[model samples]
Target: MTDLNALEDWAGPLLRKIEPAGRAKLARTLAQQLRKGQQERIKAQRNADGTLYTARRPHKLRDKKGRVKAKAKMFQKLRTASYLKAQGDAKGLAVGFTGRIARIARVHQYGLRDRIAARGPSAQYEARELLGFTVEDQEALKDLVLAHLDL
Candidate 1:
């Protein structure tokens, strides 16, 4: 299980000052902000390290006649499949993507190897760090938390 407690040191004091309902609202808002940051990073093809994702492998876009055809970028489907859901309760709020495509994100994020097709050999993809925390993300989170507390 992911430990959200690590964030307590940062937002705990502010969270404690709010009522239960307000805390839930703040958590939901924070979750949305985090989701937006991740989506932006993926769209920009950048990892948490600020490095560009590996150039997409070229696709075979030629027919037998050597005519060029358009091709989609690698992970295009996965990127478009991104989503964020916030779950709030009296205890706190949890936000995450709940879909099969999230598995693909985890694979790429960790550079894990898996088979592309049945009977095919496993292939390893580069680590993309799609959902990692960045410096900008920290600043954004802080600003968002403060703003929400103000309301």
Candidate 2:
């Protein structure tokens, strides 16, 4: 058999015990850093491909009166296969990453405000992946390294 230890190497030392506190700590750290970079990139830019990436959309709600709801902000939904059926039925928008995805892309709206709310960017991002050195930036490798860490 081809060596799968490389997979283990690609994974951190915590690969064998994803549920343990040590792995959880590393995952949280990595997730935080990853998310931060994405936010900054979106923030520094004005329009996301001229259509307003989810993080740049204007809030779309109004209060009891007609003042544009104070807290009504843009929304995004990142979905996976599990979320597909439910969000689709609700008329939510789904965006695909064109690569390996932990979950399907079912998020179809909103941006920063939604992201800041702790709900995270609403669009289902291709599952955060850690890939081989050779295909690092290929953008379509099916190997998702973060899967073990999160769920």
Candidate 3:
């Protein structure tokens, strides 16, 4: 988690200078950019800290003819904009998983144990940070805010 006090101290003056309409627009743009960056990181199977996510357990399945199916990427559906939403208003912005998918995301996010299926056995999922603020993200936000302000 980021230091709220530090962020407030740093951004408060800049944010106060913008009118309400401009603040809302800035928030919306920031949310979209944050969402885009998150999707890219997820696609690369990387955490916000620049570490690779733990590999999924090998689960080989064979066709009737005995050919092994290729492994699919993780969080394919979860990474989409529909499931991973970006919401922003004059007050603030947020990028996160929405609805029932949030439950599934929580399991993997904290290395929690959960059932594999409706009646399947439980298994431990590794902790993979699905969302976080990174150093690059901070720089991008700073640049974006400066550009928005025409500074």
Candidate 4:
């Protein structure tokens, strides 16, 4: 028979007691890092001038003779460019908005993320069992985490 409780051994007594605090601290650190990181990203990321996306502008119909009925322009922003670089921006090959990768990004205003915790402890927890650690879900957690920890 498999001892389901055996996992507790690995977690140790802290699992029941310290885990919450550790996790809260972790969450707190995560929020602070993410927020600062996002700010840095925004600061570093060049103000996008244009991109391959939807655009809106005033326009006018043209005549066969080449008479302009109206004038207009397009609007767009390439989100890809703003993407955090591999090492310089993110810690490593950043993943899409998910797990720890996302939790890290949650602090960002635009939710832009780096790729640091791709395959580490934070990554493992965020992906494996950080149930409420998604971008959308981390909102309340962010507040709580911030409150719990110094950061």
lDDT of each: 0.71, 0.32, 0.87, 0.34
Better of 1 and 3 by TM-score: 3
**TM-scores of all candidate predictions against the true structure:** 0.79, 0.27, 0.93, 0.23
Give one digit per residue, the lDDT tens place, for model 3 in 64-94.
Answer: 5868788899998899999999988889999
What's the lDDT for residue 101 in model 4? 41
lDDT of 2 by residue, 9-109 (tens): 65645455455555555444444333433333333332222223334334456545767644433222222223222111111112223342322222222
Pitting candidate 2 against candidate 3, the one with the higher TM-score is 3
Error of 4 at 81 (Å): 24
Q: How close is candidate 1 to the true structure, as a TM-score?
A: 0.79
- Which model, 2 or 4, shows the larger lDDT? 4
Model 4 reaches what TM-score against the true structure? Answer: 0.23
Q: What is the lDDT of residue 35 in candidate 1?
A: 70
Winner by TM-score: 3
Candidate 4 lDDT, tens digit per residue, 34-60? 434433333444222211222223344
For residue 57, model 1's alpha carbon misses the true position, in angstroms, by 2.9
